[model samples]
Target chain A: MNMPVSQEKKKIFVTVGTTQFDELVTRVLHPDMLEIMEAQGYTHLIIQIGRGPEPQIPTSQRIQITVYHLKESISSDIKDASLVISHAGAGSCLEVLHAHKPLIVVVNQKLMGNHQLELAEKLHSERHVVMCYPETLKTTMTVFNTSSLENLPINNQMALSNYIEKLMGF
Target chain B: MGSGGHTGEMVRLLSTLDFRHFSPRLYLVARTDDMSAKRVQQLESSHISTAGLFQTVSISRSREVHQSWITTIVSFLQSTLECLRILFYYQPDLILCNGPGTCVPPCIIALLLRVLWIKRSTVIFIESICRVNTLSLTGKLMVCFLADRSIVQWPELHAKYPQTVFLGRLV
Candidate 1:
């Protein structure tokens, strides 16, 4: 009934914009492991559409595919989506957390030059989001991205918000 | 001195430069005060005059909506406007841009006032930043259609944007 949700399909938005996602979806220890994600009871996946290289999930009658691009749409789409799997951008991480959705952060190492590894590691320590490193993505992605967001901590987000507000005087 | 081809690269180089030679005043802008001040302090203490502009949107875990598109827009606009104001006040001879969205607006202002108008101010780009193409969609848009003198780290990037001058390796 709300805007942005087209239908009631079990959609999982796994953004493969940054190189981090490219590496994860492309380099499976089992090259055919995309079947696992398809069979994981997902009705569809919305990936970030880009020129040339992008994530490839088997598209068929049963499994539908959609891609969301444009930096402007990020805040809106991230809010509308049921679940978010995205890069470990400070803004993205903060937005996903603000939405109170459990986030699976895939860091783009090649682009970030290992900076995201540091961001993800620091945030993971704070229990903010799940980190999916390229080396351990296959093994850890399943368990790490269970999408159980019931355990929401209202305190930290509010506290951080308050701190930022006080500092900004807005 | 800086990394990448645009403002971030400039931030890195101008940061390392002997601003003490001129005691240049500076202003740093960001989306929120969430970013720690250590980096800002270091740049300032190195003889560059400095100040910051940031305001954050409230995000609580229990709130009905998680992401505020409105807040994000406001934050961007405010940071951009503040960056413009910083330009009017500091009037630095050069502006160093890092890849952050906060820097884009001011860089654009600098471009209009300096580059387009042919003001003598320098706008140097950092060569060792995260390449925008492979970054989040927003990251790419943040640097759209800007940057005057780009000090690109990779020879490949120089070919990607022929306008970017291929400076030597970033330190």
Candidate 2:
């Protein structure tokens, strides 16, 4: 069944969040992946490759993939995204979750220590995000359709807000 | 604020703040941190009435994860002086900071002010949710000596640092 033209154009924002994750970038920009993304209705793939060499992907007529070396603000990209594919950085994860965007968090194993992996596991267990390793990304993407991702529970800031309010004695 | 995830978490925590009560807010970022500054500006533009309510200051980082000790000491001294200048000018009632090496200078300045009986700004530190087993370098140093209140997002962290409050995940 063909979906409406308006509904067919989805935007996917890919970011490595300050550090280099060349592995993930290479995986995403693979021709097979691009073809799959296009088939799945992604019209735009906005990639923020932080501190990493530019990804080499041939321009496709079907999917408009834009790559940036680094961006000062990705809020606009996040806001425009139908899905967010990101490194397991707390900032990126929180931003995507806060925006209520469907997210696939790829853990960068090269990072020093287990913090990133722990965070990814925690969020994955909570069903807040889909987590995958760089090597498993292709298979993960194949099995994991965007429709399977549930809308994340809205983060409740009121607890902290009220706590701060009382701390300020206001 | 530190760049990347630290900035994002700080923004979330700040978002919950009653800006009416926390007027004339002073936001500090590392000199090279275009990302954090931009994120803070975006937050300010959306929620607050006008940009005039808050100010952004860019200071230097004391140390990178891997840097020479001499460079660290020099940067620390420079950043400390910068923090002192800002503290004197602002004299804020409360200083809210998350885990970042950049936070150390201002926090030290705040502690010194309290010791000198010059100023008494409550210094609150929130450890990043990313920290699961061990405290970040900044958290380990600040919680024991400086911060008036330190919070952890994970129960395990709070268990490890029993003094720090466990408020659950900020994200």
Candidate 3:
């Protein structure tokens, strides 16, 4: 049977940057979760698994899956993504937010101090990214819409430049 | 700088610099952290006009994640000595750091140099953007005495500290 013409290629990119969160990789690939994504009209799932074991993909019917360990840079992948699911590292979160993509930040609760949770929660309050634990990722995905989110402030990264210039008397 | 988020943020911050004025830059990473060295190189080649305008120096991490307190003393002293050597050799005009354990020793050395009227290397420390409600241990130390200019990314931190400059998302 021919696929419906209305079905377009929508890719969901899941990244755990520079650190392994095996639980996220496992949870997102669970058949139930795949069905959720399929129901939501996503056609592809690309995962960047950082220092983790290669994920086992169940024999699939509809959605396509791709996995890789790392990349020199992930900005291109992020740019191509329809929605991004990322670990709650500041680097990954900032990259996605700066790209203005809809994001779901999965907090790695196993880590000590849980500063990642703090960052995710703060962003969630601002409606910039949705925050969920690995255990809740399925439910979060089932309800998540890639349509609406707030914009981050136009990057003030240049402010640091001016401050450094002033300090150095340049 | 340390690896992971620390290096990522520092690289982003450094990329904002006008390399013409800040040429001959020095990046100090944990001696074992090859990843950060690679990142610094990437940032330099992409952002700077010339190669060899920047140099990277490797030093031991003053405190590693989950390191025990007893061994921390030894590692901290070792890193402190290394930072002293590096600073004395370079006597750089400015020292910029974020909240990595590797940064503490250099900040201390910079403060000592300033207090002794030997070198006036202005030290600036930025708290990680992750710190929303509370400061990291290194952040508290910088606020207490180390930094000449302390910056925080979140407005809540500035409201709590009052002393830190809130510049709103520096990296």
RMSD of 1: 16.5
DockQ of 2: 0.54
- Interface C-alpha root-mean-square deviation, candidates in order: 15.6, 1.8, 1.0
The residue pairs found clashing in candidate 2 are A91-B5
lDDT-sorted candidate list, best first? 3, 2, 1
- Once fitted onto the true fold, the runs of candidate 3 whose alpha carbons sit more than 4 angstroms away are A1-7, B48-52
DockQ of each: 0.02, 0.54, 0.81
Instruction: Point out where model 1 deviates above 4 Å.
Output: A1-8, A16-21, A25-33, A49-61, A145-170, B1-171
**What's model 2's overall lDDT?**
0.84
Ranking by TM-score: 3, 2, 1
Score residue A113 of candidate 1 by CA lDDT.
Answer: 49
- Local error of candidate 1 at residue A25 (angstroms): 4.7
The residue-by-residue lDDT of candidate 2 on B74-161, one tens digit each, is: 9999999999999988998989888888999999999889899999998888888888767888898878988988888887788988
Best by DockQ: 3
Query: Per-residue alpha-carbon lDDT of model 2 for A1-170, expressed as tens digits?
Result: 88666645689899998878999999999888888788778899999999999778786558998999876668899999988899998878878887888899999888776577777787888788899988888777777766666665655557677777788788
How far residue B85's Cα lies from its native spot in candidate 3, in Å, is 0.9
Question: What TM-score does each model's chain B reach against the true chain B?
Answer: 0.62, 0.94, 0.96
Q: Give residue B76's error in model 2 in angstroms.
A: 1.2
How well is each residue in B59-168 modelled by candidate 3, as lDDT tens digits? 98888778999999999999999989999889988888999999999999998888888899988898998999889999999988899889999988899999998888
